[model samples]
Target: MPRFVFIGLLLLVSYSGMPQDKNVSQGRSTTSPHMAWEDLLQEHVQEDGRVDYKGFLRDKQRLDSYLETLALQPPKEQWSTQARMAYYINLYNAGTVALILENYPVNSIRDIDRPWVKKRIQVGAERLSLGDIEHKILRKMGDARIHFAINCASISCPKLPAYAFTESGIESQLNQAARGFINDPQRNTISPKQAEVSKIFKWFRSDFKAEGGSLVDYLNRFLDEPVSKGSQVKFLPYDWALNDILP
Candidate 1:
């Protein structure tokens, strides 16, 4: 072979042999591990949205797997707003489930010492409690609709939807959750004469105001029977009983 041809062949072989960063070269999107958690929730939770802690305990391994993924693979900052919101919402809900299973058979999540504020489980590159995900992350994200999406494993907390929140469907799910929680007579007894709402509205009053306006304004937006102006605003006492369904 001619010297020039041999040199060219050697250069081509060397270039082909160069290593590429698998993560960078392929430009792979992050695969969410939340699917495992979502599947577990659907399988164990009743159609009414109450959870079966006993069944969740039985599937401890699956729960742990989901948590492991969360601890290691939290959503990247580069992701879109919807993706981040969906990720944190799932983390909060799934983490809450794990917290319940930690003390399975307990009557209430409050039975534990400051369960929400407790820093125990690992998630998103750090050990974060339920409160951290809710207050520190989700709340700062500036969407009041999150209150309806994150369940605290309690009777008074918003219902856990049968399906998990996804980046693509988060907007719709949030809207549905807001409407469901507000309009549900059981949770919030909104009357034209006297408006009674969930403690959530009272607790996160600022969020609702930010979302729309005052609590009454927010309620009127969803409520079929609008709460009349100057209607009595009363917050119902929160129930701390475990939102569990018996088999």
Candidate 2:
């Protein structure tokens, strides 16, 4: 072979031997990934995002299958930021629902014994709790909008969407989630002089402020009427009642 062609071939082989990104090594599985969970949410979750917990309990099998899939297929570092966020968001929501169903007939998610840190879930090779999914992983992913994405099945939590988030539309979904949560009057008491919002905005103020400078600056992006500078802001009390639908 010509010297030039031989060098080119050698370089190609050497480059191919280098390790790939963890998530990129094997293409992320997109195979009906969250359909089961999505189907359940679409069917049983109300337009306002209230869940029909009784109906969910009756259709527990689908949730079990979805959880199994999540446990088997863990997301790796190489996945797109959008995809990683979506997966964790879905995992958090689905896992939370399963947790609630396991201890059903309860009035609220806090009824369970140490529910957030129980380490009862089998996610890939490790056991994780809702706390791990939220604090350890998703929070470190660096999106304050996530505060609105992960629901804890509580009334004060951001309303869980009727549709599941997918890599394809995660951005828009997150944007909508933020807007919906921040603008909902029942949760946010907003006015020119003051803005009292969910405890979430208080707890994760840094996250929202990071994106738009300050809490007020962020709210103006979504609020129809902007909160003026020097406005007094209060954190509303969190309602821990189950976000379940009534018969």
Candidate 3:
């Protein structure tokens, strides 16, 4: 009888000594791991739009720990209008990169469509397809400017900002997205006679117009040189490839 009691006490002590999840320790509980957008942006951004993926990978363990906490938090009560938008934007960007990494070393994102990497990933409690996030959450959500924000990890895709999403910075974020994309020589740029533009402006011209006028008119607000009347617009070929920074 005494031996049985001693064994039971030993088991209890061992269980108590087990490490607890970090999120519980911090008082913010979550199931999955994620880094807040604010913290990510502060640490990653360079003067140019280029983000430091290497730095992110360096402290990946802590970042993953935080994300686990975020996931455990209960699903939000009625995604706030602004918060929903912000979450979708973050989802699309983060999910896209995560998707790309699933099949790294591919020539283009197209190759991943074969069998394995094309499978759905659960992001923020939503099982999302790369297309669903791009079309449904982003486009169907009634926002057109997103085309300029989420990077496909390609030179042609709009530069992905180093920071995370915040409601306070939404307007400025959209403005910067617009300006940076339009100014990218590979995405959209004006030369005296010949000009190149992103398929984004072509694919969703109506989305932009819903807010006011033509995309060119919308773009002119940000460009240094005025877009002359009746200037021809041509689509630039996009490289849908993995944007891995080779070591």
Candidate that scores best on TM-score: 2
What C-alpha RMSD separates each model from the true structure?
8.7, 8.0, 9.0
The segments of candidate 3 whose C-alpha lies over 4 angstroms from its true place after superposition are 1-78, 114-119, 123-125, 191-195
Candidates in order have lDDT scores of: 0.79, 0.82, 0.60
Error of 2 at 153 (Å): 0.8
> Compared with the true structure, what per-residue lDDT tens digits does model 3 show for residues 1-247?
6999999999876533312223332322231122354456457545455545666566555455444433334235554544455556665666555545455555666676632235364555655566776776677767677878777666567777765544445566677778777777766768644456788777788888777776667767777676765677788777665454444
The CA lDDT at 176 in model 2 is 89
Estimate candidate 2's alpha-carbon lDDT, on a 0 to 1 scale.
Answer: 0.82
Superior candidate under TM-score, 1 versus 2: 2
Structural similarity to truth (TM-score) of each candidate: 0.84, 0.85, 0.70
Best candidate according to lDDT:
2
Q: In what order do the candidates fall by TM-score, top score first?
A: 2, 1, 3
What tens digits encode model 1's per-residue C-alpha lDDT throughout 1-247?
9999999999876433312112211221233335577678778988767998888999999988877866766666566788778778887888888888989889999997889898987865578888888999899999889999999999888898766666666787798888888888878887688988888988889988987667798888767778887788999999989999964
Comparison by lDDT, 2 against 3, better one: 2
Better of 1 and 3 by lDDT: 1
**Two-way TM-score contest, 2 vs 3, winner:** 2
